[model samples]
Target: MTRIGFRLALAYRSNIIMTCVALVAQVFLLRMIWTSVYGSRPAAAGLTLDALLAYLTLANLQAFVTHTIVSRIIHDRIRTGMVFFDLARPVGYLRQMAGFQAGNTLGGLLLLAPVIPVVLLVGSITVPVNGAGYVITLVLGYVIAVQLALLISLIGFWTMEIGAVSLLYRLVSQFFAGTMVPLAFFPGFLGVVAEILPFKYMGYVPAAVYVGHISDISGPVVVELAWIAGLWGLLVLTWSRAHRRVVIQGG
Candidate 1:
Protein backbone atom coordinates (compact mmCIF):
# COMPACT_ATOMS: atom_id res chain seq x y z
CA MET A 1 0.00 0.00 0.00
CA THR A 2 1.04 3.60 -0.56
CA ARG A 3 2.21 5.60 2.44
CA ILE A 4 -0.79 7.90 2.11
CA GLY A 5 -3.17 4.93 1.90
CA PHE A 6 -1.72 3.20 4.93
CA ARG A 7 -1.58 6.38 6.96
CA LEU A 8 -5.19 7.19 6.12
CA ALA A 9 -6.29 3.66 6.93
CA LEU A 10 -4.64 3.75 10.32
CA ALA A 11 -5.99 7.18 11.17
CA TYR A 12 -9.44 6.43 9.84
CA ARG A 13 -9.74 3.20 11.76
CA SER A 14 -8.63 4.80 15.01
CA ASN A 15 -10.72 7.92 14.57
CA ILE A 16 -13.83 5.90 13.72
CA ILE A 17 -13.57 3.75 16.82
CA MET A 18 -13.14 6.93 18.80
CA THR A 19 -16.10 8.40 16.96
CA CYS A 20 -18.33 5.45 17.92
CA VAL A 21 -17.37 5.79 21.55
CA ALA A 22 -18.20 9.45 21.35
CA LEU A 23 -21.47 8.81 19.51
CA VAL A 24 -22.69 6.31 22.09
CA ALA A 25 -21.87 8.69 24.90
CA GLN A 26 -23.61 11.56 23.15
CA VAL A 27 -26.69 9.46 22.47
CA PHE A 28 -27.05 8.55 26.13
CA LEU A 29 -26.61 12.13 27.16
CA LEU A 30 -29.22 13.20 24.64
CA ARG A 31 -31.58 10.59 25.97
CA MET A 32 -31.29 12.17 29.37
CA ILE A 33 -32.00 15.57 27.90
CA TRP A 34 -34.99 14.19 26.07
CA THR A 35 -36.37 12.74 29.27
CA SER A 36 -36.09 16.04 31.06
CA VAL A 37 -37.63 17.99 28.21
CA TYR A 38 -40.52 15.61 27.80
CA GLY A 39 -41.13 15.36 31.51
CA SER A 40 -42.72 18.81 31.65
CA ARG A 41 -44.66 19.15 28.42
CA PRO A 42 -44.45 16.12 26.18
CA ALA A 43 -45.59 17.16 22.73
CA ALA A 44 -45.54 20.20 20.55
CA ALA A 45 -47.90 20.70 17.65
CA GLY A 46 -45.39 19.30 15.15
CA LEU A 47 -42.82 17.44 17.23
CA THR A 48 -43.61 14.30 19.24
CA LEU A 49 -41.89 11.92 21.63
CA ASP A 50 -41.10 9.57 18.79
CA ALA A 51 -40.13 12.47 16.59
CA LEU A 52 -37.92 13.91 19.29
CA LEU A 53 -36.06 10.66 19.86
CA ALA A 54 -35.86 10.26 16.13
CA TYR A 55 -34.40 13.73 15.84
CA LEU A 56 -31.79 13.08 18.50
CA THR A 57 -30.67 9.80 16.94
CA LEU A 58 -30.49 11.18 13.42
CA ALA A 59 -28.74 14.31 14.63
CA ASN A 60 -26.10 12.30 16.41
CA LEU A 61 -25.56 9.89 13.53
CA GLN A 62 -25.43 12.54 10.82
CA ALA A 63 -23.15 14.79 12.82
CA PHE A 64 -20.79 11.93 13.54
CA VAL A 65 -20.83 10.67 9.98
CA THR A 66 -20.54 13.98 8.18
CA HIS A 67 -18.21 15.97 10.40
CA THR A 68 -14.73 16.48 8.92
CA ILE A 69 -11.88 18.43 10.47
CA VAL A 70 -9.19 17.82 7.89
CA SER A 71 -8.10 21.40 7.37
CA ARG A 72 -5.22 20.39 9.56
CA ILE A 73 -4.07 17.91 6.92
CA ILE A 74 -2.78 20.62 4.64
CA HIS A 75 -1.63 22.83 7.50
CA ASP A 76 0.44 19.98 8.92
CA ARG A 77 1.85 19.07 5.53
CA ILE A 78 2.69 22.62 4.59
CA ARG A 79 4.30 23.53 7.89
CA THR A 80 6.40 20.37 7.83
CA GLY A 81 7.27 20.78 4.12
CA MET A 82 5.52 17.45 3.48
CA VAL A 83 3.57 19.34 0.89
CA PHE A 84 6.78 19.47 -1.14
CA PHE A 85 6.53 15.75 -1.68
CA ASP A 86 2.96 16.14 -2.85
CA LEU A 87 3.96 18.82 -5.31
CA ALA A 88 6.85 16.76 -6.73
CA ARG A 89 4.66 13.72 -7.40
CA PRO A 90 3.54 12.97 -10.96
CA VAL A 91 -0.12 12.55 -9.97
CA GLY A 92 -2.37 15.52 -9.40
CA TYR A 93 -2.27 16.49 -5.76
CA LEU A 94 -6.06 16.81 -5.66
CA ARG A 95 -6.44 13.21 -6.86
CA GLN A 96 -4.11 11.99 -4.15
CA MET A 97 -6.01 13.86 -1.47
CA ALA A 98 -9.34 12.62 -2.83
CA GLY A 99 -8.15 9.04 -2.61
CA PHE A 100 -7.02 9.56 0.95
CA GLN A 101 -10.33 11.12 1.92
CA ALA A 102 -12.26 8.28 0.26
CA GLY A 103 -10.31 5.74 2.26
CA ASN A 104 -10.95 7.70 5.40
CA THR A 105 -14.68 7.77 4.69
CA LEU A 106 -14.70 4.07 3.93
CA GLY A 107 -13.11 3.33 7.26
CA GLY A 108 -15.58 5.61 8.99
CA LEU A 109 -18.52 3.78 7.43
CA LEU A 110 -16.95 0.52 8.49
CA LEU A 111 -16.67 1.58 12.10
CA LEU A 112 -20.26 2.76 12.11
CA ALA A 113 -21.49 -0.53 10.69
CA PRO A 114 -21.20 -2.42 13.95
CA VAL A 115 -21.79 0.49 16.32
CA ILE A 116 -25.06 1.52 14.64
CA PRO A 117 -26.79 -1.85 15.07
CA VAL A 118 -25.54 -2.15 18.63
CA VAL A 119 -26.79 1.33 19.47
CA LEU A 120 -30.20 0.60 17.99
CA LEU A 121 -30.49 -2.74 19.68
CA VAL A 122 -29.49 -1.43 23.07
CA GLY A 123 -31.33 1.88 22.86
CA SER A 124 -34.43 0.37 21.18
CA ILE A 125 -34.35 2.93 18.40
CA THR A 126 -35.33 2.57 14.79
CA VAL A 127 -33.96 4.96 12.21
CA PRO A 128 -36.23 7.22 10.18
CA VAL A 129 -34.54 5.87 7.07
CA ASN A 130 -35.09 2.93 4.74
CA GLY A 131 -33.00 1.05 2.20
CA ALA A 132 -33.17 3.22 -0.94
CA GLY A 133 -33.30 6.60 0.79
CA TYR A 134 -30.54 5.47 3.05
CA VAL A 135 -28.33 4.63 0.14
CA ILE A 136 -29.01 7.80 -1.85
CA THR A 137 -28.87 10.40 0.91
CA LEU A 138 -26.04 8.68 2.65
CA VAL A 139 -23.93 8.86 -0.47
CA LEU A 140 -24.98 12.45 -1.16
CA GLY A 141 -24.23 13.68 2.34
CA TYR A 142 -20.95 11.79 2.41
CA VAL A 143 -19.81 13.48 -0.80
CA ILE A 144 -20.97 16.85 0.44
CA ALA A 145 -19.14 16.43 3.72
CA VAL A 146 -15.89 15.36 2.03
CA GLN A 147 -16.05 18.14 -0.53
CA LEU A 148 -16.64 20.69 2.19
CA ALA A 149 -13.60 19.44 4.07
CA LEU A 150 -11.48 19.56 0.93
CA LEU A 151 -12.56 23.12 0.20
CA ILE A 152 -11.50 24.11 3.70
CA SER A 153 -8.18 22.28 3.35
CA LEU A 154 -7.53 24.12 0.10
CA ILE A 155 -7.58 27.34 2.12
CA GLY A 156 -4.25 26.26 3.57
CA PHE A 157 -2.43 27.52 0.51
CA TRP A 158 -3.27 31.03 1.64
CA THR A 159 -3.76 30.73 5.39
CA MET A 160 -1.93 28.78 8.06
CA GLU A 161 -4.83 29.31 10.46
CA ILE A 162 -6.97 26.53 8.98
CA GLY A 163 -7.15 24.67 12.28
CA ALA A 164 -8.73 27.57 14.07
CA VAL A 165 -10.78 28.35 10.99
CA SER A 166 -12.17 24.80 10.82
CA LEU A 167 -13.07 24.96 14.50
CA LEU A 168 -15.01 28.15 13.88
CA TYR A 169 -16.61 26.61 10.82
CA ARG A 170 -17.83 23.62 12.83
CA LEU A 171 -19.27 25.86 15.50
CA VAL A 172 -21.15 27.94 13.00
CA SER A 173 -22.21 24.94 10.98
CA GLN A 174 -23.89 23.59 14.10
CA PHE A 175 -26.08 26.63 14.33
CA PHE A 176 -26.69 27.10 10.62
CA ALA A 177 -26.98 23.49 9.55
CA GLY A 178 -29.12 22.59 12.53
CA THR A 179 -26.66 19.92 13.55
CA MET A 180 -26.21 21.29 17.07
CA VAL A 181 -29.94 20.85 17.45
CA PRO A 182 -32.69 20.41 14.97
CA LEU A 183 -33.98 23.51 13.20
CA ALA A 184 -37.46 22.52 14.33
CA PHE A 185 -36.48 23.76 17.78
CA PHE A 186 -35.26 27.09 16.43
CA PRO A 187 -37.46 30.14 16.52
CA GLY A 188 -39.06 31.45 13.37
CA PHE A 189 -36.41 33.82 12.05
CA LEU A 190 -33.48 31.49 12.63
CA GLY A 191 -35.45 28.63 11.12
CA VAL A 192 -36.08 30.74 8.03
CA VAL A 193 -32.39 31.41 7.65
CA ALA A 194 -31.49 27.76 8.12
CA GLU A 195 -33.95 26.77 5.45
CA ILE A 196 -32.34 29.07 2.92
CA LEU A 197 -28.76 27.88 3.38
CA PRO A 198 -27.34 24.72 1.84
CA PHE A 199 -26.19 23.69 5.30
CA LYS A 200 -29.52 22.10 6.17
CA TYR A 201 -29.43 19.84 3.14
CA MET A 202 -26.12 18.40 4.31
CA GLY A 203 -27.50 17.14 7.62
CA TYR A 204 -31.09 17.87 8.60
CA VAL A 205 -32.79 17.91 5.23
CA PRO A 206 -31.37 14.64 3.99
CA ALA A 207 -31.88 12.83 7.24
CA ALA A 208 -35.34 14.24 7.66
CA VAL A 209 -36.23 13.39 4.12
CA TYR A 210 -35.19 9.82 4.64
CA VAL A 211 -37.01 9.76 7.97
CA GLY A 212 -40.15 11.37 6.51
CA HIS A 213 -40.24 14.56 8.62
CA ILE A 214 -39.49 16.59 5.56
CA SER A 215 -42.61 16.46 3.39
CA ASP A 216 -41.14 18.30 0.43
CA ILE A 217 -37.95 16.59 -0.61
CA SER A 218 -37.85 17.93 -4.13
CA GLY A 219 -36.97 21.49 -3.17
CA PRO A 220 -34.16 20.50 -0.88
CA VAL A 221 -32.84 18.10 -3.47
CA VAL A 222 -32.67 20.90 -6.03
CA VAL A 223 -30.94 23.21 -3.62
CA GLU A 224 -28.53 20.48 -2.62
CA LEU A 225 -27.63 19.84 -6.24
CA ALA A 226 -26.96 23.53 -6.68
CA TRP A 227 -24.76 23.61 -3.63
CA ILE A 228 -22.91 20.52 -4.81
CA ALA A 229 -22.34 22.13 -8.18
CA GLY A 230 -21.15 25.35 -6.60
CA LEU A 231 -18.87 23.51 -4.20
CA TRP A 232 -17.35 21.34 -6.95
CA GLY A 233 -16.76 24.42 -9.09
CA LEU A 234 -15.14 26.11 -6.16
CA LEU A 235 -13.05 23.03 -5.45
CA VAL A 236 -11.72 22.99 -9.01
CA LEU A 237 -10.91 26.69 -8.91
CA THR A 238 -9.29 26.50 -5.50
CA TRP A 239 -7.27 23.38 -6.35
CA SER A 240 -5.91 25.02 -9.48
CA ARG A 241 -4.99 28.19 -7.64
CA ALA A 242 -3.44 26.28 -4.75
CA HIS A 243 -1.33 24.21 -7.10
CA ARG A 244 -0.19 27.27 -9.01
CA ARG A 245 0.55 29.15 -5.79
CA VAL A 246 2.66 26.31 -4.41
CA VAL A 247 4.65 25.99 -7.65
CA ILE A 248 5.36 29.69 -7.75
CA GLN A 249 6.15 30.02 -4.02
CA GLY A 250 8.64 27.07 -4.11
CA GLY A 251 7.53 25.66 -0.80
Candidate 2:
Protein backbone atom coordinates (compact mmCIF):
# COMPACT_ATOMS: atom_id res chain seq x y z
CA MET A 1 0.00 0.00 0.00
CA THR A 2 2.85 2.35 0.83
CA ARG A 3 4.57 1.65 -2.47
CA ILE A 4 1.32 2.11 -4.34
CA GLY A 5 0.77 5.47 -2.67
CA PHE A 6 4.30 6.65 -3.48
CA ARG A 7 3.81 5.70 -7.13
CA LEU A 8 0.41 7.36 -7.22
CA ALA A 9 1.85 10.57 -5.77
CA LEU A 10 4.66 10.66 -8.28
CA ALA A 11 2.25 9.86 -11.12
CA TYR A 12 0.76 13.36 -10.71
CA ARG A 13 3.84 15.29 -11.76
CA SER A 14 1.93 18.44 -12.60
CA ASN A 15 0.20 18.47 -9.24
CA ILE A 16 3.46 18.12 -7.35
CA ILE A 17 5.03 20.93 -9.35
CA MET A 18 2.07 23.26 -9.02
CA THR A 19 1.76 22.62 -5.31
CA CYS A 20 5.44 23.40 -4.78
CA VAL A 21 5.13 26.57 -6.82
CA ALA A 22 2.10 27.68 -4.84
CA LEU A 23 3.86 26.96 -1.55
CA VAL A 24 6.92 28.93 -2.60
CA ALA A 25 4.78 31.87 -3.60
CA GLN A 26 2.91 31.65 -0.32
CA VAL A 27 6.14 31.64 1.68
CA PHE A 28 7.42 34.77 -0.06
CA LEU A 29 4.10 36.54 0.30
CA LEU A 30 3.93 35.74 4.00
CA ARG A 31 7.53 36.77 4.45
CA MET A 32 6.74 40.17 3.02
CA ILE A 33 3.72 40.55 5.26
CA TRP A 34 5.66 39.59 8.36
CA THR A 35 8.56 41.85 7.41
CA SER A 36 6.22 44.77 7.08
CA VAL A 37 4.55 43.95 10.35
CA TYR A 38 7.83 43.84 12.21
CA GLY A 39 8.83 47.22 10.67
CA SER A 40 11.96 47.65 12.81
CA ARG A 41 10.41 46.19 15.92
CA PRO A 42 12.56 43.38 17.24
CA ALA A 43 9.86 40.95 18.33
CA ALA A 44 6.25 40.36 19.10
CA ALA A 45 4.88 37.61 21.27
CA GLY A 46 8.44 36.55 22.07
CA LEU A 47 9.23 35.85 18.38
CA THR A 48 11.91 37.87 16.63
CA LEU A 49 11.71 38.68 12.91
CA ASP A 50 14.11 35.88 12.02
CA ALA A 51 12.44 33.38 14.31
CA LEU A 52 9.03 34.29 12.97
CA LEU A 53 10.16 33.89 9.38
CA ALA A 54 11.75 30.58 10.17
CA TYR A 55 8.58 29.50 11.93
CA LEU A 56 6.50 30.50 8.94
CA THR A 57 8.77 28.62 6.55
CA LEU A 58 9.02 25.47 8.63
CA ALA A 59 5.32 25.50 9.55
CA ASN A 60 4.25 25.82 5.93
CA LEU A 61 6.56 23.01 4.85
CA GLN A 62 5.38 20.77 7.65
CA ALA A 63 1.76 21.53 6.80
CA PHE A 64 2.36 20.66 3.16
CA VAL A 65 4.10 17.41 4.01
CA THR A 66 1.45 16.24 6.46
CA HIS A 67 -1.61 17.28 4.48
CA THR A 68 -3.73 14.31 3.36
CA ILE A 69 -6.62 13.72 0.98
CA VAL A 70 -7.93 10.71 2.83
CA SER A 71 -11.39 12.21 3.05
CA ARG A 72 -11.56 12.68 -0.70
CA ILE A 73 -10.38 9.11 -1.25
CA ILE A 74 -12.98 7.78 1.13
CA HIS A 75 -15.73 9.91 -0.39
CA ASP A 76 -14.95 8.84 -3.91
CA ARG A 77 -14.68 5.17 -3.01
CA ILE A 78 -17.93 5.24 -1.08
CA ARG A 79 -19.63 7.08 -3.93
CA THR A 80 -18.40 4.60 -6.53
CA GLY A 81 -19.09 1.58 -4.29
CA MET A 82 -15.42 0.59 -4.45
CA VAL A 83 -15.29 0.90 -0.70
CA PHE A 84 -17.01 -2.45 -0.49
CA PHE A 85 -13.87 -4.08 -1.80
CA ASP A 86 -11.85 -2.28 0.88
CA LEU A 87 -14.18 -3.67 3.52
CA ALA A 88 -13.79 -7.25 2.31
CA ARG A 89 -10.01 -7.13 2.58
CA PRO A 90 -8.30 -8.85 5.49
CA VAL A 91 -6.52 -5.71 6.60
CA GLY A 92 -8.27 -3.18 8.78
CA TYR A 93 -9.57 -0.24 6.77
CA LEU A 94 -7.89 2.30 9.05
CA ARG A 95 -4.54 0.51 8.81
CA GLN A 96 -4.72 0.45 5.02
CA MET A 97 -5.46 4.15 4.94
CA ALA A 98 -2.61 4.87 7.39
CA GLY A 99 -0.13 2.90 5.27
CA PHE A 100 -1.15 4.80 2.17
CA GLN A 101 -0.95 8.12 3.97
CA ALA A 102 2.51 7.28 5.33
CA GLY A 103 3.70 6.56 1.78
CA ASN A 104 2.11 9.74 0.49
CA THR A 105 3.92 11.66 3.24
CA LEU A 106 7.21 10.11 2.14
CA GLY A 107 6.44 11.19 -1.41
CA GLY A 108 5.79 14.71 -0.18
CA LEU A 109 9.12 14.62 1.60
CA LEU A 110 10.83 13.72 -1.69
CA LEU A 111 9.08 16.59 -3.45
CA LEU A 112 10.35 18.96 -0.77
CA ALA A 113 13.96 18.48 -1.79
CA PRO A 114 13.80 21.30 -4.32
CA VAL A 115 11.54 23.56 -2.33
CA ILE A 116 13.70 23.48 0.83
CA PRO A 117 16.63 25.27 -0.81
CA VAL A 118 14.38 27.99 -2.18
CA VAL A 119 12.93 28.67 1.27
CA LEU A 120 16.34 28.49 2.90
CA LEU A 121 17.60 31.23 0.56
CA VAL A 122 14.64 33.37 1.57
CA GLY A 123 15.60 33.36 5.32
CA SER A 124 17.38 31.63 8.17
CA ILE A 125 15.68 28.87 10.17
CA THR A 126 16.90 27.81 13.57
CA VAL A 127 18.22 24.37 14.40
CA PRO A 128 16.03 22.27 16.60
CA VAL A 129 16.43 23.04 20.30
CA ASN A 130 16.12 19.39 21.15
CA GLY A 131 16.88 17.22 18.14
CA ALA A 132 15.65 13.95 19.58
CA GLY A 133 12.58 15.55 21.13
CA TYR A 134 11.77 17.35 17.88
CA VAL A 135 11.86 14.12 15.92
CA ILE A 136 9.68 12.26 18.43
CA THR A 137 7.05 15.01 18.51
CA LEU A 138 7.09 15.46 14.75
CA VAL A 139 6.42 11.77 14.23
CA LEU A 140 3.69 11.91 16.87
CA GLY A 141 2.27 14.95 15.10
CA TYR A 142 2.04 12.95 11.88
CA VAL A 143 0.12 10.20 13.59
CA ILE A 144 -2.33 12.71 15.08
CA ALA A 145 -2.74 14.31 11.67
CA VAL A 146 -3.52 10.96 10.02
CA GLN A 147 -5.90 9.93 12.75
CA LEU A 148 -7.77 13.19 12.49
CA ALA A 149 -8.00 12.86 8.71
CA LEU A 150 -9.25 9.29 8.98
CA LEU A 151 -11.90 10.33 11.47
CA ILE A 152 -13.10 13.04 9.11
CA SER A 153 -13.02 10.63 6.17
CA LEU A 154 -15.14 8.14 8.03
CA ILE A 155 -17.94 10.71 8.01
CA GLY A 156 -18.44 9.86 4.34
CA PHE A 157 -19.78 6.50 5.32
CA TRP A 158 -22.99 8.24 6.28
CA THR A 159 -22.98 11.59 4.43
CA MET A 160 -21.91 10.07 1.06
CA GLU A 161 -20.70 13.56 0.02
CA ILE A 162 -18.18 15.10 2.43
CA GLY A 163 -16.78 17.87 0.25
CA ALA A 164 -18.15 20.73 2.34
CA VAL A 165 -17.45 19.06 5.65
CA SER A 166 -13.94 18.19 4.59
CA LEU A 167 -13.28 21.72 3.37
CA LEU A 168 -14.56 23.20 6.57
CA TYR A 169 -12.46 20.79 8.58
CA ARG A 170 -9.34 21.75 6.64
CA LEU A 171 -9.97 25.45 7.06
CA VAL A 172 -10.72 25.25 10.76
CA SER A 173 -8.04 22.74 11.53
CA GLN A 174 -5.32 24.62 9.67
CA PHE A 175 -6.16 27.87 11.38
CA PHE A 176 -6.23 26.32 14.82
CA ALA A 177 -3.31 24.05 14.09
CA GLY A 178 -1.00 27.09 13.70
CA THR A 179 -0.40 26.58 10.00
CA MET A 180 -1.39 30.20 9.39
CA VAL A 181 -0.20 31.81 12.65
CA PRO A 182 1.28 30.55 15.86
CA LEU A 183 -1.17 29.77 18.60
CA ALA A 184 0.94 31.94 20.87
CA PHE A 185 -0.25 34.93 18.89
CA PHE A 186 -3.88 34.01 19.32
CA PRO A 187 -5.49 36.28 21.94
CA GLY A 188 -7.77 35.63 24.89
CA PHE A 189 -10.44 33.01 24.33
CA LEU A 190 -9.04 32.04 20.97
CA GLY A 191 -5.71 31.09 22.53
CA VAL A 192 -7.58 29.17 25.17
CA VAL A 193 -9.55 27.38 22.51
CA ALA A 194 -6.43 26.49 20.55
CA GLU A 195 -4.72 25.22 23.66
CA ILE A 196 -7.57 22.84 24.43
CA LEU A 197 -7.84 21.50 20.89
CA PRO A 198 -5.73 18.64 19.48
CA PHE A 199 -5.02 20.61 16.28
CA LYS A 200 -2.10 22.49 17.86
CA TYR A 201 -0.17 19.28 18.40
CA MET A 202 -0.27 18.62 14.66
CA GLY A 203 1.55 21.69 13.27
CA TYR A 204 2.25 24.15 16.07
CA VAL A 205 3.90 21.96 18.65
CA PRO A 206 6.37 20.38 16.25
CA ALA A 207 7.31 23.67 14.59
CA ALA A 208 7.45 25.41 17.92
CA VAL A 209 9.79 22.76 19.18
CA TYR A 210 11.98 23.24 16.14
CA VAL A 211 11.97 27.04 16.53
CA GLY A 212 12.68 26.92 20.27
CA HIS A 213 9.32 28.43 21.15
CA ILE A 214 8.79 25.21 23.05
CA SER A 215 11.91 24.48 25.09
CA ASP A 216 10.47 21.75 27.25
CA ILE A 217 8.69 19.20 25.10
CA SER A 218 7.93 16.87 27.96
CA GLY A 219 4.46 18.34 28.58
CA PRO A 220 3.55 18.66 24.91
CA VAL A 221 4.78 15.15 24.19
CA VAL A 222 2.66 13.77 27.00
CA VAL A 223 -0.40 15.64 25.72
CA GLU A 224 0.27 14.40 22.22
CA LEU A 225 0.45 10.83 23.42
CA ALA A 226 -2.80 11.24 25.33
CA TRP A 227 -4.51 12.70 22.27
CA ILE A 228 -3.25 9.80 20.16
CA ALA A 229 -4.68 7.26 22.56
CA GLY A 230 -7.97 9.11 22.87
CA LEU A 231 -8.27 9.65 19.13
CA TRP A 232 -7.50 6.03 18.29
CA GLY A 233 -10.25 4.87 20.63
CA LEU A 234 -12.66 7.30 19.02
CA LEU A 235 -11.59 6.11 15.58
CA VAL A 236 -12.26 2.53 16.51
CA LEU A 237 -15.76 3.34 17.68
CA THR A 238 -16.48 5.52 14.64
CA TRP A 239 -15.17 2.90 12.20
CA SER A 240 -17.33 0.25 13.77
CA ARG A 241 -20.34 2.45 13.25
CA ALA A 242 -19.26 3.43 9.75
CA HIS A 243 -18.72 -0.21 8.91
CA ARG A 244 -22.33 -1.00 9.60
CA ARG A 245 -23.62 2.16 7.88
CA VAL A 246 -21.85 1.68 4.55
CA VAL A 247 -24.15 2.15 1.56
CA ILE A 248 -22.84 1.36 -1.91
CA GLN A 249 -23.95 3.89 -4.49
CA GLY A 250 -22.84 3.27 -8.08
CA GLY A 251 -20.51 0.28 -8.14
What Cα-based lDDT does every candidate model obtain?
0.71, 0.84
Candidate 1 TM-score versus the reference: 0.87
Model 2 weakest lDDT span, ten residues long: 242-251
Model 2 residue 104 lDDT? Answer: 79
**Candidate 2 local Cα displacement, residue 130, angstroms:** 2.5
How far residue 10's Cα lies from its native spot in candidate 1, in Å, is 3.8
Give the per-residue lDDT of model 1 (tens digit) for 67-171: 664556667988888988888889887777767767555666666888987666533466554546555665676677777888888888887557787888787
- Which candidate ranks first by TM-score, i.e. highest? 2
Per-prediction TM-score: 0.87, 0.95
Model 2 CA deviation exceeding 4 Å by range: 247-251
lDDT of 2: 0.84
**Candidate 1 displacement at residue 171 in angstroms:** 1.8
